[model samples]
Target chain A: MNIQNPEIENNVFDVRGLNLWYGNDQALKNINMQIEKNKITAIIGPSGCGKSTFIKTLNRMIENVPIVRTTGEILYHGNDIFDKSMRVEELRTKVGMVFQKPNPFPKSIFENVVYGPKIHGIKDKKLLMEIAEASLKSAALWDEVKDRLNDNAYGLSGGQQQRLCIARCIAVQPDVILMDEPTSALDPIATLKVEELMDSLKQEYTIAIVTHSMQQAARISDKTAFFLMGDLIEYDKTEAIFSNPRDKRTEDYITGRFG
Target chain B: MSAAKLEFLREGREDTMLETDQTHAFERYKVKIDSGRIERRVRLNNGLKHLFSLSTVFALVVLAILLYRIGVQSAGWLDLQFLTSNLSRFADKAGIYGAILGTVYLMLIVVPVTLILGVSTAIYLEEYAAKGRIQRFIKVNISNLASVPSVIFGLLGLAVFGRMLNLGSSILAGGLTMSLLVLPTVVVASQEAIKAVPGFLREASYGMGADKWTTIRKVVLPVALPGILTGSILAMSRAIGETAPLVVLGIPTLILKIPDSVMDDFTALPIQIYYWTLDTVLTPEYANLAAATIVVLLAVLFILNSVAIIIRNKFQKRF
Candidate 1:
């Protein structure tokens, strides 16, 4: 079910001159990139390189911190998301986020999947059930967990928990999904499963993922962006960036000369 | 090698003699057993010191004796009829029914109101309020209130709700006073329970796009409920046994009928016992009645504590 419509707008998020500061410490500086619609964009960087911070800023989740401040524009479908007219709650619904660790709510698996829809006022049980089944199937967990949906979510394995979290995000029907090192906490087998899920998910939703694994970024992303010291060093096609990067720093990092 | 050995040096023999002399001196000391006996004596002395450290056991024995005395004195009067019948003017006919009714009525009012107010205040402080001087002040004041004597609270209730507001000397006034006296304890306990809920649940709820109040209502409260209920039950038990506050609020000492309204005069079990004990001509019969009331109060407290323990155990199992 590849839903990549090439005629659709290529740039879903157009970030320009974006800068972020946490009190006296500057975390992001002059980050400019174009995130394509219905494509997976992976941000790869070393530790403390602000990849997570940059993705968090896309949905204004970083602004919840008291000392965080941002300058510049993040145009989501040609509208500035940071504009005063923008409702944060609405923006959050449109741009959902999944954390690094698998954090399913301490509830039944069915309840965990349907929590987002219920909060958005989807009261009809049939509709909620349909959405939950669709989401679980999309995350590649329906066949395994469909029969025991009433069981506690914590009873699932680490990979299943991560997939459940993904299902929860998909249930909200968000336009974009932001993942912060979604597979970093999983085993190789679980990581492979998540990578496969990401490949299928990009057909329906734009994804911005921050990962420390360069191999994972190259394997799953259509486009790849490299960040260092809070700066977007290079943004290009994943194969091109890995094989023959234009930037000397990007080449050095990919070739393992220095982080 | 044989030729070299044949030329044994005189210096070597002198060194061997010196080594043999040192060995002989070491053997002389090694044969002695006096130091071994000294070590054994030291160990015995330490063992005797440890054997005398039984003060805790003695203290426990004294406590058991005191409890036995109270239990023995109160055992004869604890009859079923003494609990079911109403208080009579004559000492022989007196029963704890009026006091029991009053206590029940007081609990009916105090339990629900205090639970709601206490849990809400705790949730607000734990979940919604921003960290600042005002929140800190409120927290400190609540801690102080929990320690304030119940008699002082009774005085406050008398002035504020009884005389000035003219609620009159009724069960309503007494219940409200006791509620205020126990509110701080409930809040503190509930706050601790709310705090025990993991931070990840809150983040998970917020991540789901639920509003703050909705998150609290659906996630935080349910997870913290067992702890909150435990605290509320303990607080209610404390409220039930309170005598001074009711005394100050003028809880009637002798009433034949159950309270019909909040404004009606009522006699709690503690007040009834106090009245019987203080009668100028206190008889064995009256003492027996007081003892029976005491036994009933203890039973109620035990039941409430057990309920709290059961709830806590259930929550532990789930977690």
Candidate 2:
């Protein structure tokens, strides 16, 4: 369900003047964007652009890298994420992430799904089972994998593994889910399934996806942000960005003139 | 109709692409593979394979010869008495009972202390230490320690464990010395196993709000366990066969009584074999006893390696 924000109310993430550097190389420049709650936002750009970097910044996952320097204010529910008082583990729980590759733990599908809940002190088997079933259903994979819940996750197809990762993310009951090129590794049919999953997922979790496919942004995202050379060039409704971009660079990129 | 027929006949021979004169000699048929070149390559490959086979056969022949020699000497001597009775001044009554018990006691001390200390050091270096010069320095030294002669570790043990701590030549001192000799191997191996865990797994755990220690315990350790166990067993195997460290620690080669406790004096298999081999001048039967002990020591190493292989195969995963 696309968020029909007649008047956008809550800003799930309010990023302002965000700049990040890797060692001596600058990766992201002054960026400002307001990510709306319960909406699917797609970050699109060419190779070497800061789209992935920007998505990582929202959850502070980028800080996992050494020699990374960031200066900015990212307010999640109006609290500065970079503040020293903020606990990374707590932040990550609220802002769950699905990576580009399907990285399910080398474990049973049931275990993979309940990993988050189990770690969060959910010891009841019945509760964990319920959460796992609900998560798999939400990711649109329950019918296909229900009978084989105890099988190793690696035994699943690549598409199913990616869906399992999505199931894993939602099992944590996260408020915002950040996906970094989640379907770049999947085939077209699998890609379509995940795209459909996103439409439903955004009803619960605020999603910000990074993708190289402009058509995907248009197809799935309600809000689209274009990044180029570490700078955020344009941000608007997906329809407008694809139909009538205001900036010359945005037009050039959308029209396939230059990337 | 006659004019159309003439035009068709003329068109068939035109450059519209199938003229006989346009065809080159090389285009007449497909090229053939040079059999001579292939033959030379095959010959070279076969020659090298033969050499490799010979090298392998040489190693197997040597091993077979040694096993046969040991088996011959062990005839009549490797009986139930040898396994159960203690060392004796006489040949027929001499046994490895004391050495076997001592070895078991040594392992009891070595296994827990080495695993706890080595695995913790590995975890600290891999999970907690910054990826910089300090970590590299400690890592390099640990690896270097593994390569240093076991005798050097024995000297260290003699100076520190045997003298400074004043445990004397007791089983405790000998076990500690051997542990020092093998702890580096365990640490290096555990580090490699821990490092082999996927980075994304840790990220997933952390994203689930698990703390670093919790993540390591739940994710890293489980994934790396087979490797850690294999390494530990292999290191312990090395300790089991060690004679130099025991010698430096001065564990007597003639303890006829079983070591009932860690503080008690002990006689290990290698030390018994060493004394037996040296006392062959007294009676040739000592040589046979030494050979019998070798067979038993070989069995211990074999069991350890077998366990290692079993764990590795059981835990081997596609990822």
- Say which candidate scores most in DockQ: 2
Q: Please, what is the TM-score per model? A: 0.86, 0.91
Error of 1 at B32 (Å): 28
lDDT by residue (B56-90, candidate 2, tens digit) is 99999999999999999998899999999998899
Tell me the spans in candidate 1 whose CA falls farther than 4 Å from its real position. A1-8, A257-259, B1-63, B317-319
Q: How do the residues A122-170 of candidate 2 rate in per-residue lDDT, one tens digit apiece?
A: 9999989999999999999999999999999999999999999999999
Q: What's the TM-score, to 2 decimals, of chain B in model 1? A: 0.80
lDDT of 1 by residue, B95-183 (tens): 78778888888988898889989999998998878867899999999999999999999999999889998987787888889899999
Q: What TM-score would chain A of each candidate receive against the reference chain A?
A: 0.95, 0.96
Clashes (candidate 2): 0
Candidate 1 chain B: worst 10 consecutive residues by lDDT?
B1-10
> What do the candidate models score in CA lDDT, each in turn?
0.86, 0.90
